[model samples]
Target: MRKIAILAVGFAPNQSEITETISLLISLSEFKAQFKIFAFDRSTPLNHHELYDLESLNPKDFDALVLPGGIGNATHLSTWSNDKIKMTVNPTVEKIIKQFYEESKPIGAICMAPIVVAKVLAKHNPNITLGENFSETHLVEGWKVTVEKCPSTDYITCRDTKVITTPAYMNDATPFQVFTGIRGLTKELVEMA
Candidate 1:
């Protein structure tokens, strides 16, 4: 079975992060993949499955890596502003990402998580999307729900980098749409493996 390492950036994080990780997990469950949650925090939601600390994980052990969005404050941990401060993604995460890339393993990112990946692999110039149409608000009946801008059920892959990304909740998409996009990303990531 192929092993996948999932990092929740800052704990199973918020609702979005939890949902995103679970969504990815559910998607990957349909394949021949075994996964472990690599949380930034010391504690994670307890379950029959075991958890590992991100700092202690080695990229060599996992076939692929997945990072789900929900990094509200942890976003400050990464710096993509310029090359001078290229020391982003914290040391552990940076090393993990670089090692995966070096070994030609696939990596997947969803929603705002792509920023972290792009920032870490700035030199690679990864092709990613955070769900477009942010310029317009989605208006619906009953409530003023912002117009749903898409790329919802679609994903982007950086062929050279072997990195896959999708716009999960980035466009305020529905859970079904988010899951669809995530499933697509997971499919591509597993294929690359």
Candidate 2:
């Protein structure tokens, strides 16, 4: 049994974090049956099987940590540029991440979740820019239904210097790209355990 941690925040991009997290967790079944999914925000929706707080979580107990995609992950759980001041992730989560790093634990973050990864890297190197690509719009039927851009880092750093990131979306105008996918980390992260 391997313990895995998944953070869920409130008010995120539809199908971003939830879909990705569920997919990653399901894929983990190939490795182990025991899992601990943690939802950080009180407003977050939860499955009966998932846990609800960081207070009870011990980084040592888990073999790996996964951060999923979402606007919430971008804006709240990662670095945010605001009014010339750069802000980073929730303090508690950051602390846990630092601990995970010290122990050389595997981490998987997708989409905006990488911003947190960038910050973690900065703590040591401070020279890495978590590159973000703009102009990636969600278009459909030749109509730009939604404009999507990562205002922060998309590649998250993990133990052994692993970085997992993606830029995926579905629509007629916004065609899919192979680089914009999530399953790649499923194999990498789960295999670490």
Candidate 3:
């Protein structure tokens, strides 16, 4: 089984972002895949949440990395808040992303999570999608990423790197649409693996 590392926010995370991808990956008959979740906050102990401390693990252990999008991603993965205009990406999360990039491992990012990808891969100017929101599209473009508007059921793969992205709930999509987006993201990552 291939192990994929999923990065999530420590606070109230969007459950669907993580659950849908995981469920679809497990249901695949073509390949067996397993996932390990890591959180941005290291101080919080794991409980009902299946998250492990991201700082404690080596990026080398996983074949690929996944970033699920949610409001928490803006709050925790980066320094963005509801009231803040300027945001700083978290150093720890940035470091992990850099490690994955250096290793040439496939990365799957969804919705607002592409913001983190854009921040880390600014030099590459990776082509990605974040749904149809014009404001969010401009936000990522400011970081030097090439934004492609895509439907919630589809995804965009960067040409220069092994990064795949999808717009989950960012499109005001139904649950089924979000699930299809995640499933497409997972399939692309698995193919890269």
lDDT of each: 0.71, 0.52, 0.75
| Residue-by-residue lDDT tens digits, candidate 2, 16-39 | 456556655666676564667665
Candidate 1 lDDT tens digits, 1-193: 7888887654444523766767888899987688887766645563555667778788888899988876431353354323222325677777888899999999998876776666677677666775775331221111211122347788988888898988788776788888899999998998888
Task: Rank candidates by lDDT, best first.
Answer: 3, 1, 2
- Show model 3 residue runs off by greater than 4 Å: 11-31, 41-49, 82-86
Give the CA lDDT, 0 to 100, for residue 143 in model 1: 26
List ranges where model 1 is wrong by over 4 Å: 10-16, 72-87, 134-150
Provide TM-scores for the models. 0.81, 0.68, 0.85
- Residue by residue across 1-193, what tens digits does model 3's lDDT show? 7788888775444432454444444533345677777876545543444778878658899998988777777777886555333577888888999999999999888877887777788888889887887475676677677999999899999857888998887798887888788888888887796
- lDDT score, residue 53, model 2? 78
Which scores greater on TM-score, model 1 or model 3? 3
Where does model 2 exceed 4 Å of error?
A: 10-16, 79-85, 125-132, 135-159, 168-180
All candidates in order of TM-score, best leading: 3, 1, 2
